[model samples]
Target: MEIIHHHNLAMKTEEEKLPPLIQAIAAREIAGFDNANNLHLHDLKISILDANEEQKQVSISMPSSPIEVHVGSSTLYPMSDSAAKFHSQPIPNNNKLKYQRFDSFKTWSGKLERQISNLRGKPCEIHENDDIENLPLDRFFDALEGPELDTLRASEEIILPENEKWPFLLRFPISTFGICLGVSSQAIMWKALATSDSTKFLHVTPEINLALWLVAAALVAAVSAVYSLKVIFYFEAVRREYFHPVRVNFFFAPLVAVVFLAIGAPPPVAGKLHSAAWYALMAPILCLEVKIYGQWMSGGQRRLSKVANPSNHLAVVGNFAGAVLGAAMGLKEGPVFFFAVGLAHYVVLFVTLYQRLPTNETLPKELHPVFFLFVAAPSTAAVAWTEIRDSFDHGSRIAYFIALFLYFSLAVRVNFFRGFRFSLAWWAYTFPMTGAAVATMKYADAVPGAGTRLLAVTLCGVATVAVAALLVATVVHACVLKDLFPNDMAIAISGKRPKMTRKWRHRYRRRSSSSSSTTDSDYCQGN
Candidate 1:
């Protein structure tokens, strides 16, 4: 072993230049060192499954091959004297830290984390998992057959790899940045890349323009995330007072669903149906509201009336905000489709906003004010797009439809999740709908562009596998609906609780009118 130090970029030092003291630190993963996911803490002897080009050519690879590495503990693998010394130090106990049983290598570490963490009975499974542990060098090398192998040599210096990169410590920064213009840049980034403009020439402003696109994408990604967070927070905040009757109840869920249906809705019959599909959006909102707010109607009227829930009111604000944002983003880049997509979304929001009807046909002061302002968000979003649609390209329009689905589906249930918990069946279908939207944008006869139309397809495929893995796990008590508000569900549909059961009616008729209330209360004590 030998050692060499350099002060300039062009300098080189081979492994032979390091002394044994330094060489000891450079050996491939040593037993008891960190593993890929930081899930387990243990050490194992290495066996080469593959090697990188540089490693294949080298007499010895960095973190000398065939050495054991630790899993739960931190250790230096560079073999540098400084790193070796760094690895040898002992770490203190952290009661708060828990780890999963990491297999040490896999493409979907998040799933692995979820599985293992569940096995260990926890959510997040890392304590102090910061360590440059090495995997079997050969296996690691064999995996990187593309430019992604070294694509981010410089970026990885500070940022670790997500599934977006190799190894799984890095996460797609959804939380770090917030939404700005509308829709996250990830969707917009795909739109931009797929829709190449003649203006994007190589000799002209390629570098400058490309940089702008990337920066713009990062900003949008941040914005979309923030928008999601904001919507969910608002929903949760508004629902604080009412936790019964599944009050909010999928306020915007069906909207994502309609985006997919839009593809199939292209036929003349389909067009009329999809165009008029606003009825589907009206059901849940109108039903829930009639139950919640329209309780005072007379017998005949109550039978026909309904009430709206508190959280849905808030969702009206959040989801419509998203629709506006989505349409706005597509406005400049797309045309007819953006407006059409937005109009479709506005229908959903409008339905949700005024979902309730009075049982007795009597007007409530709150309904007009809440529904009016609530309707404003989607209305403004819709009109904005309709007015600007001519300037937007068809590609933007298609993307806008997909954007509508993603925004409406992702966070709607968090506030109103009851019977419709994390439904894999829902996501499985929704994902493909999103993909179809990307395709519609890609092939919509507007500007020509290439897109990862297959990205969402691939995701849909993955989701299929995931659904199989999904378990019917329910934590919240289903009885909350009955226990908290026994009449809510019935009220939503019938505009009133079902007429007292036949037996109760018969018994009440036989009882004295004066004691009717007391006798009925005793008869249905639990309810």
Candidate 2:
């Protein structure tokens, strides 16, 4: 035992004699090493890298000293729920301390590795998200307009039908009313022809006057035929207007009655038949007056501002025309009633229209029914008054004077008249002008004055010139212009196209093809 103890002391003395640096190097070479192939980290209950990768609380025994954890060369602080992993080889329990420096070149790489689990538990915070739900909806709505505010308003457009649009001869059936002028002028000429004393002033014989009556009668027939075509083709338009709750359309009724009265004066079977028709028509005309007048009063004129044109007095003119016809037929009661109604209603209409109607410049010249206000109503009244009283009485004189003054007012604006477009409304000028001429002749005969005779002669000359011009224009428009039919009714009963329509259609086809080609090329370029 003494020898064994002496040998152990000798070996310890030799190892203690070795260099200190060699001994430290030998210690480091034998120390435990952690590497990627064998090292792992897990929780007490589960591995963070498990298939489910669910997070759970882990109980770990913390060391008093700090730990140096390495993951892919990244140095990390101690994890809150970490468990140290070791290789299959057991590490020596030594108290030796060691330090190692990391090189910049190999900074992001290491022999050891680590895996992160439970990605949902360590989600990165987002700075901003522009979801629509996060917008200030209440603030936006508060800035909007209120419910009472009107975002849109209305405007008016004159949408003329293709038929009534410009470049048509029979654009409107209202032109048929021009028949009244021919009939009235003929009646006056016939009266003058029958008077032996009239030859000196008129410078025409009874035979010439008879020929004029025949011509006037022919004109009446032509107009009636044209109007019949209008009724057949445009029944709905005529019916709607005829029964409208307004008095202007009522004028056309009396115009028909005037034709009957004119024909009745000649003492023939045709005259008797026309007179009978006139008598039959009187009842319906009276009914129409009552309906229109009653509605005008009751409705308080809902559209008065828009419709208060001088045409409103046309109703009054109709009554007077009826009175003249009734007197010619020797109907005492009818003439008196019609005359009174016409006079009273016309006064009211005149006052209202004068005050309320738009200015001349504001009104379109094509729609100048206002000219009739000064001419037709007063002249018709004068004629009716002369028939009732059998002379130029106070009422007849007053009516004549008013008619003359109104005529002058229109005459002074001759340039305006010339500026007017060719429309059915031009027919308005014919009736009033003829009526004035008739009134002048009646006044001259009743007064028996030189000045009156000269005035009568001048007016008749003017009426003749006007009628002749209108006739030429009508024939030219119908034959040459070929615009006599309204739109779709352009084809005649014989199924022949109008000359103008054939030309227009050819032009339309050429333009349409050119426009279509241009549009197609434009579309291709755009695409």
Candidate 3:
């Protein structure tokens, strides 16, 4: 538990004969247990009050979890009498310095080997927390050496496991989607949709600007309604016990949820879509971890425990990048509104699959078919609309169909080639999910002249039964796995029951008020 900056300090605990010059911290302060034998230590608290200017000696100690703070300024050199002298800076007498990594140390570590590189240097002065939620520590260290890292300590509540840094080790892909959402295709589509609808525009109003606003709001509202309803339905599935927030997303995923209105915030900054979605996707994950952290901090409200992993967070990063790509391509030709809405729907599909996989947790053989549904979902959504749009206007040359056809087919083959085996149940479940996407196309198009009309309906029917069965089976499975649940599935009940919980608390308080009054009277009479 002796946390030292340079590799000059061996991993061995306090083996030196001389007392540390500063003794800035002690082992007992950080790890309360005399766990001098454990592989790694936690509870990294060190007091560095003993810096001796005359001796140029300093010491710092912290658990090697969350962050590894390295003090580049400190230096150690071997003495003639089997002792090591410590210095605050590179010794002038010996211009050559040693660079330490973990255990062993090498001599002279010349300027080039010991050189520091900061490619993504901060242009402006480092603000207190310009990007608290997205600290980008690697970028920070890349900009400054170990000594400078101390100046950039974060105030944000980072929730990563041991040996990681918040905003840096976190795998959330917020920037990508946030940027995409900021420059949302839906916005452009509404503008185009209005311009294209010349007849309606002419009929609308005397004021040209007013008419423009109406069209913009109408199309925006239409697409927004679609995505909002999507969120509602997906959550309702969980509310109805079809999805378990904890069991599905037991690990902290990144923020992948596009919760535009939930926090009532402005459109995310460019490049933040990916990061935001990662954070959103991991919202449940983080809260779940917070519960673990809470129990530990509170000395165990419950003796039971929940294992932590970063599966969903990694998935959010992957999917946020993926969702953005799907959105950009999906909207390239069709009404951007349709493309964004379609991509948003695909997000729902991912949220479901994400419920099953870790953010980057390797896929299990049993979940192989899941990849088909994974590849097929966005591809199919992109294709379904293109198929309809193509049928109505033979002249329509939108290449969505070709792109989706090629992309998904290639993706599926890649997954299979990668040797990810799917269980028979996956085939049984996914083909139906695939069928639902097929059937979903027909529901939107019933025109007589449409070439894809009948085929769409046929796919719709097949997918309907498949999706229904999958939904039923999924819901049952989500509810039945109590071990997967937080507090035995507390994530489910804790998720949507926040308000209901408040109401129940109020009711309990009211009843307690009267019961206490009666008890007081009885006590007085007894007295």
On lDDT, the candidate that comes out on top is 2
Distance from true location, Cα of 308 in model 1, Å: 16
Per-model TM-score on C-alpha atoms? 0.22, 0.55, 0.24
lDDT of 1: 0.31
- Whole-model Cα lDDT per candidate? 0.31, 0.52, 0.31
For each candidate, C-alpha RMSD in Å?
Answer: 28.3, 33.2, 25.3
Ranking by lDDT: 2, 1, 3
Candidate 3: worst-modelled 10 consecutive residues by lDDT = 488-497
Candidate 1 residue 378 C-alpha distance from true site, Å = 12
lDDT of 3 by residue, 1-527 (tens): 34555443542223432455632223233444234454354333223321221232223222334333244444433222222212122224432212111001111222222233223452333223211222232333222111111111121121112242212101111111222221122232222222322223224232433333344344335434543443343332222221222223312211322321111122233224444453444345345544543442354212112212222222222232333333423333323333444355345435544464322233333333334434333433433444445442321222234323433453455334334321122322333233233322323332333444444444434444544454454345436641111111111111111233566667656754664575455434423
lDDT of 2 by residue, 471-494 (tens): 777677668886543432211111
Better of 1 and 3 by TM-score: 3
Which tens-of-lDDT digit does each residue in 1-527 have in candidate 1?
13332422124233324344532433244443334343432333233222122322122223222333344543324322222212333345564322222222122343455678788878764422221132232321222211112111111112122322221111111111211211221233233233334213312323432443454455445444543553443222123113222222333333322322222221233234432344344345445444433332233221212323222333332333333333433333333333344455445444543454322121221121122223223323332343354333544454445444544453253322222333112222222222333333333334443343334334323433432232112112213321211111111111112245677566545543434454344334312
Mark the 10 consecutive residues where model 2 has the least summed lDDT: 148-157
Q: Which stretches of candidate 3 lie over 4 Å from their true place?
A: 1-370, 373-391, 394-458, 483-527
Give the best candidate by TM-score.
Answer: 2
